[model samples]
Target: MDATLWKNSSFLKLWLAQLTANIGDQCYSFALLWYLLQATKSGTALSLLAIPEMAAGLMFYLTGGVLADRYSPRLLMAGTDAARIVVVISVGVMASFGVGQFGFFLAAQFLLGVFSSLFQPARTVALKSILPLELLGRANGILDTTFRSIRILAPMTIGLLAGSVPLSALFFANAASYLVSVFFVLTIRDSLKGKGGSTASKLTLGQYKRDIATGASELRHTRDLFYILLFGNLGYLVWLVTYNVGFPFLAERMDQGNGSTLAMLMGFYGIGNLLGSLYMARACYTRHLLVVLIGWMMQAAGFLLLTGGPAFHWLAFLGAALAGVGGPLIGIPSVTAIQVKATDANVGKVYAINMLMYTCCGMLSSCLGALWLGKLPVERLFLVSGLALVLLTVVGLAVEKRNHTTKHHSLDL
Candidate 1:
């Protein structure tokens, strides 16, 4: 990791922008989700909120990839933020004016999702350009940790203002954050935005198809990235989806619907995640997959402990913290590998492919989480999650061993 990472002004600007934006996003989500649950009195509505976003990612990720690779990432990022501001403001206006329709909210979610899909690829491209490859892991760590922290603090802060503040306030705050984000993004030097892969006239139908094919080929040939994207992330999916949907239920069952307990568990998880990300930022490694598998194993053990958590409060906090620590272990290395290994020309497209995988799996996991929560006990769900991680870890270890052996034999020859 670069010791001067803290001194890098361009990266700092980007980091600050991301920090403010994520905090706003957290606030908006907390406010809107509460509204939905109150309006519909259905967990299904909460689940439904994620659907349109995933739908947009599925539909637009490829196109977003093409554009990011073919244009100025700086412009794309700023433009996306500008568009988000409008969408968020629109949502607030509708709510303030007494609009009660759920579909209207879903439509707003879909539009925001579109910008998210675009911004994600562009953001990666921008990051790769901002700093050298050596600092990439630490940068990713900074962003991930900030996001996790906001996930913990933002909701609680909103809860504190429940009666004093209006829900529309969250929406407007989110828009303002985006407005600030756009300003920071534009302030970045123009020379830093890497040139696009194709000219406007060259991006014809046949060329677009070829560009997509090229990115797919690049990803298929990248062994580490392919494995992490497919299997390692699958394990992470188990941890993220199950825990998110299960936490409130655990709180309900264990404490007789106490919100404080839920908040406490989340705090432990967030703190652990912060520490793990800091570790990844300072630590160095060439075998990214090993770090990811180790993370999964740690989380698996945490989940196993969590099966006994509801019965014992100490175990619950300990388990949540351990699981939280595993997240950055899996995430930072995977992202760094892409930033370092993927060809510069294809980096955006490759990242888009990665995000697309997340979108598809996210939708599946959301449904499975809802189904499992309805049918299985919370203890059993934690057990299943833990066991699933154990399975993924075993498979990943086997693959790593085989790859190492193959490389050694070829060297000997």
Candidate 2:
């Protein structure tokens, strides 16, 4: 519970590794997008880049989860980090030779996605293994804050670099960052159980199936955790729809609908997110349901304000900030709940499934928003999704309360 979580050398090393890798990935992503736009001048080019990446990630997540549970996360993570370094460096080499084709970039993106899927489950398990139970919440808060902070700055930083540095240099820089992360990962000594047991035997298909089943069984047994995850994923879907699709459309419709205004909106949201992350790192909230409920409501308010309705158009920035603040309120507690409830044996699967659901939600939002954006006004979408989120949050809280009371009454009887 001490706020000085960095005192733990293992956690510090893991955090640094993750930080470096995240920044590098962001830069790589920005560079890829920029290159695609300049080369193709078609929206389909972006889709071609994103869809394959998403598909690769989705296809590998469950397998990654199983591997995370079956093997040493430290080794798995390091290996994947090394693999990505090779992939990125290869791409950089190709770029240096004037081979910046869409197909080449797509291949690199897909490889990165595959490696990322493998890395994520392992990273989650590794973090849990290194950090104590009491510090999970704080560590998660700090990590989330760090990621958000990077997101806020990475685009701008990369944009500045895009003007001065070649895409090949950016790719090489990303590879170098991953190489640094590999060093940090190798330095950490994981005290996780069953470290060397993974290499002892060949895994049969039946065994792999059984491992995945056990993970699913673990979730099925934890009823509260399951419901929380369900609501959390759905909430994420709604948030994604509003933010990704609705925000840009609304911004364009607003007066002075320029890049600067849109950037200001995002900047405000990032500041709020940064503050929220810092707040959660320092303070502990015992009631997760209340936290989630408050977060959803705040998020809903933000979305509604973003609707750009009469007399409320100027308050859109405030809405963005509220949404940012509300996000960590839900995310940190939800992750803590899962980590606390899951056994080490099933933790990897739980985290994997959790990530898969979140990713799928984003995909669903993107697809559905695309379909709806053409037929309806963007403000209506924002308002509806916001209200729906509010309703879902209320329902989730009520269900949890009833379950709590029912269990208590049955115990009394």
Candidate 3:
């Protein structure tokens, strides 16, 4: 990792923008969850928030991806941020007026999800434009570590403020964060140049449909990429289930408050992620594919320990740390690989599909885990997650080996 990338004005601007936006997102999430709990006090209502938000985000991702590839990422991101400011302000106004309508909150969340769907793909594509390919891993590591580190402070601060501060204050703060992000994003000149030529002249619903079809066909033909996405999605599923179910269960068993231990464990996890990302930034590796595989394996091992035994409190911390470490190792590489390997014309669609798969799996897993919580032991949930990881790893390794053998044979020919 070159320290020089930090000096690159474009990269610094985008990085700062992302950091600001993420902090605001964390604050909003914490505030909203607290608001929901205060209003309803029902687990079902709180869980439902994830449903519409996740579904709407996934449903729009492909469209968002298409737009990202066809247009300027800087413009797309700025536009989305501007839109979010409106939504956040509106929600803040409604909440300030003592409007406790669940439907209104849900609608606001859905709209935010839609904007997020568009923002993510465009932001991802913009990263490639800012940093050299050789430095992508390091850059991404820095980004992830910063985000994770902030998670430690953001949620608690939001919670503390929730008591005395009006919810509108948090919403206004969120809007301000978006404005700050947009200002920084506007400073990046390269992202404004756009990729490929404008397809607006020929743009139509049919053109989008054709693009999706073409992108899907290309993805289907790329078996290695497909498997990578599949394993990644599965890993997301397991992680989501463990996070949603196992934490509370373990907390109950330990006689600790439901969220206290989990929060502490998460702090340790954040530290681990920071450390792991730092290591990856400096490590010499030809490709991150191996790192992705290893990361998943470690995540699975961590889940096993987290869900394993009553005596495994220490194990839970270790597991959380491992899971955190595994994330950036896999995430940075997988995203960079997709961006580099996919045709620039279809990168948005590919990234959209990737996000949809992961989000859908996570959503589904959360629902299932919620449903199964009463019938399943916490340990069993961990065991199941570990088993799923092991299966995914075995399949990935087998496929990778075959690909290597085929390459060697082709070279001999």
Tell me the tens digit of each residue's lDDT in model 3 across 193-242: 35633544566999989888877887798766666676666788777878
What is the alpha-carbon lDDT for the whole of candidate 2? 0.81
CA lDDT, candidate 3, residue 223: 66
Error of 1 at 203 (Å): 2.4
Give the CA lDDT, 0 to 100, for residue 215 in model 1.
Answer: 88
User: Stretches of candidate 3 above 4 Å error?
Assistant: 159-164, 192-200, 256-259, 408-413
Runs of candidate 2 with Cα error greater than 4 angstroms are: 1-4, 194-201, 309-311, 406-413
Tens-place lDDT digits, model 2, residues 293-382: 777888888888877632466678888888889888878877877777788888778877887888898898887877787688877887
Candidate 3 weakest lDDT stretch, 10 residues: 192-201
- Clashing pairs for predicted structure model 1, backbone only: none
Clashes per candidate (backbone, < 3 Å)? 0, 0, 0
Clashing pairs in 3: none
**TM-score versus the correct structure, for each prediction:** 0.92, 0.93, 0.92
Q: Tell me the tens digit of each residue's lDDT in model 1 across 224-291.
A: 67887776568746765667877777777779999999988888888989889878877878787888
Cα-based lDDT at residue 89, candidate 1: 94
lDDT order of candidates, top first: 1, 2, 3
Worst 10 residues of 2 by lDDT: 191-200
